[model samples]
Target: MTVRTRRLAALLAALSAFAAGCGGESDTDLVRDTVRSYGEASAKKDYQRICDDLVAKELLRSVEAVGLPCELAFKRGLQEVKNPRVEVGEVTVNKSKALVQVRSSAEGQPDSQDTLELTLEGGEWRISSLAKAQPQPPQPAAP
Candidate 1:
């Protein structure tokens, strides 16, 4: 092959590698998407969908430890609220673990904000635990 053709081929390969590394979405995006899906399911009161996205017993135990009444709360909350909206903000991903923040509002009232911890298992991101995000401390009065 001509030197010019070989150089062009090498350049294309390098560009492809770079694009795969930086241009395309990373695993963090996948985790964020999973978190969004969870919020959508909760807002829609789709318990099965939420369960499908969870990591089963292990995750459930963690959630329960934090006093999250998964089945009952989801059902009751869904029945009480109307037209819920969930906004996902801030995702931190480290290797196979991630934390996602979600703010949910129901019936035009701000409900509660939560952070969902997740992990990559069997090539799929699953919720490991759900915890209420602590509210920011009040700012001091200015002098």
Candidate 2:
């Protein structure tokens, strides 16, 4: 083979290796994705997925505070919210923790924003806490 052809083959191999390495999502991105999944599962009342996968085991206590199983509590929470659609926003990650901002809207209601706290547990990102975001003042009109 000509020298040019050999060089091209080497470049192609390198590019393939780089693409393979990029297949895994970063920790921040994983947290954002997990939050999205949690929202979808909650809206669908798929409590099993929420309790077993999306939420950290430590959060089970809060879910069971009402004397119900975690899955049952999740179901009740979803019913109260009603058809929630979550939009994930900026995400920040620390060593084993991540925070994701999300806006959720239910039918006939204004959007509610929350900050989700996630922890890297058992090789996966799982939500540990959720808190309402502080409302910001309206911005002035642009000149």
Candidate 3:
């Protein structure tokens, strides 16, 4: 075989090895994407779309827990707001569970941060919990 041909074969083998090593996206990435999609739907006031992304039990529980008031709030807030943006920050995953931090802003208001916990079930990611990002207390009103 020619020297050039052997070098080409070696390059192809290295490329294949790298590709195999990288494999596919991690579970954390999947959960992040799912949460982002849900947020986008919520921002659009597309309750049906948001509901479609949630697990059955979560959907039922959310409806019962918040009742119709939640739906009304979404409709009112989302409909009035234009160009909402949701940013998902660094996500950490352990085993089949993961935590994703998100920041959302609408119009020109301050960004709201929250964390979402997720689990991998049935080959899909589902939100298990959500906690609001608490702001640090303001410095004691200038002595």
The 0-to-1 C-alpha lDDT of every candidate, in the order given, reads: 0.75, 0.86, 0.71
- Candidate 1 residue-wise lDDT, 1-143, digit = tens: 99999999999999999988887667878887887787677777887777666554576665557676666655764767677766778899898788888876667454677888888888888988766765444448899
* TM-score of each predicted structure versus truth: 0.63, 0.76, 0.63
> Which scores greater on TM-score, model 1 or model 2?
2
Judged by whole-model lDDT over C-alpha atoms, candidate 1 comes out at 0.75
Q: After superposition, how far is residue 7 of candidate 2 from its true place, in Å?
A: 18
Cα lDDT, model 3, residue 23: 94
Candidate 2 Cα deviation (angstroms), residue 35 = 0.6
List the lowest-lDDT window of 10 residues for candidate 2: 130-139
lDDT of 3 by residue, 3-115 (tens): 99999999999999999879977787787788888777877678665555643345437754865644564565467766777789989988877888887666755567778
Whichever of 1 and 3 has more lDDT, that candidate is 1
Please write out the lDDT profile of model 2 over residues 1-143, one tens digit for every residue: 99999999999999999999889788877888899999889888899999999988778777788699998887776777778889999999999999888887777666777888998899999999967776444447799
Residue pairs of candidate 1 with colliding backbone atoms: none
Shift in Å, residue 128, candidate 2: 0.2
Best-to-worst order by lDDT is: 2, 1, 3
